[model samples]
Target: MTDTPWLTVVRGTAPLLLSIPHTGTELADLESRLSSPWTARCDTDWWIEKLYDFASGLGATVVRTGISRTVIDLNRDPSGASLYPGQTTTGLCPTETFDGDDLYRHEEDKPDAAEIEERRRTYFDPYHAALQAEIDRLRATHDRIVLYDCHSIRSVLPRLFEGTLPVFNLGTNDGRSTDPALQEKVRGILADTGVSYVVNGRFKGGWITRRYGQPDKGVHALQMELACRGYMREPGDKASPENWPSEYEAAFATPIREKLLTILQSAIAWANG
Candidate 1:
């Protein structure tokens, strides 16, 4: 495996840049602080890198972080404010899982304010730096560039939302992050797939999309948060560390992967048009 302790950047020639921020599982030095290393990585966007492996073939630049979000969520606000205020959400350096399970054995084991800031400097900043550089590079060539942030989550988390999530949850910061036409085109493609999907519903894009999306400036950004069940077999309600993290079977993910390939192709065409 590649020793991507921090982040990995695969440069391509297309106007689209795919950002898989939560796909990493490497905990690095933070592994020692976890009560259960497996639980700490439970919320990772598993197999996302493999699902979008075809992006390189489409000439889409890929930027991914290998460090666990338990270390520092790259999609979160650096100010530690809630992305969905008045609702359940994790933090910059999360101390609990999406299900509200404790990540550390004790409260003292969690990172302090100073440690959170240190993680931002070490992990969060570099990832964004590389993403911004890619956007700048692509923007100079194409009249319009799209930053497609890829993510996935468990289908059900009562603490986060009621009932199961849609198969594809697209967000554009409530339509402020990208042009309405671009958003409509993508939504149209998803709708044709015959899969359940929503726009700017539960997830309205994260810090990365909101911070960089400038439609008027020719840079459009959008986030796609897939429910894991769309691509893989989700664990049962009482799943444990042993039975929870399912292996990535390409055969199982083919349907969604095919749809995603079309989505990326559409995004590239839209950007160039």
Candidate 2:
């Protein structure tokens, strides 16, 4: 078995923690149970972690998991509760892809309640525990901290949203996960960039943001869901198995990186203000 750590952590003094939960692509011992490796990992946030490599230089703590979401979605609630109550959303351990593609070769290989619980104990709990530990560690020195959950998806997912998603989708759980002033600062930066963005559209912060965000107490959490086109090339139509997940190019992502840097910096300033 590979001894590589399940997650990587870079401790920083800044009052910000970048919670990147979906960029992982590892399948571990569950490879054989999956239908196709590509299909199983197709929904990953893809290089979202790399997109914010500058975060450490800014002294922002970063926590990233290497285990694939197919193993167990870390952002999901451990109780298998839906982040989106009425709308369509994947579960803690999704059985299918966003496009309704089955993740397993044999339906019988699908994880049952027992296996789901095992995966939860092995993966989900530790991730959140790591996050909380960092939060507690940072909170000791700073009066306030920001837990920024970074993510990305294809611009167009017919099954997920309507026509197309904006370049930046900031979710603060309807302003409950973060301070209103901080959200305004972020929105101002997005507006100045002239890029499309929405405050609380489809995604309104996941379990981490909702559970960790204690705006009144000091820890403010926010989820930044970026559309893939902003950083990498995406298929004009719906993504297929053939033409999807373009590599992360420095030149292509340079502009988006600049804006993201500005956003993070502004949030830090606001938090420390």
State TM-scores per candidate: 0.97, 0.97
Q: Work out how many backbone clashes candidate 2 has.
A: 0
Q: Give model 1's TM-score versus the native structure.
A: 0.97
Model 2: per-residue Cα lDDT over 149-189, one tens digit each: 99998888888888889999999999999889888999889
In model 1, how large is the Cα lDDT of residue 34? 91
Best by lDDT: 1
Alpha carbon lDDT of each predicted model: 0.90, 0.90
* Tens-digit lDDT track of model 1 for 1-273: 122556788989899999999987888677667988888889999999999999999999999998899989999999988889898899999999998899998888998989888889999999898988899899889989999999999898899899999999999999999999999999999999999999999999999999999999988999999999999988878447877778898999999999999889999998888
Model 1 lDDT, residue 256, Cα: 97
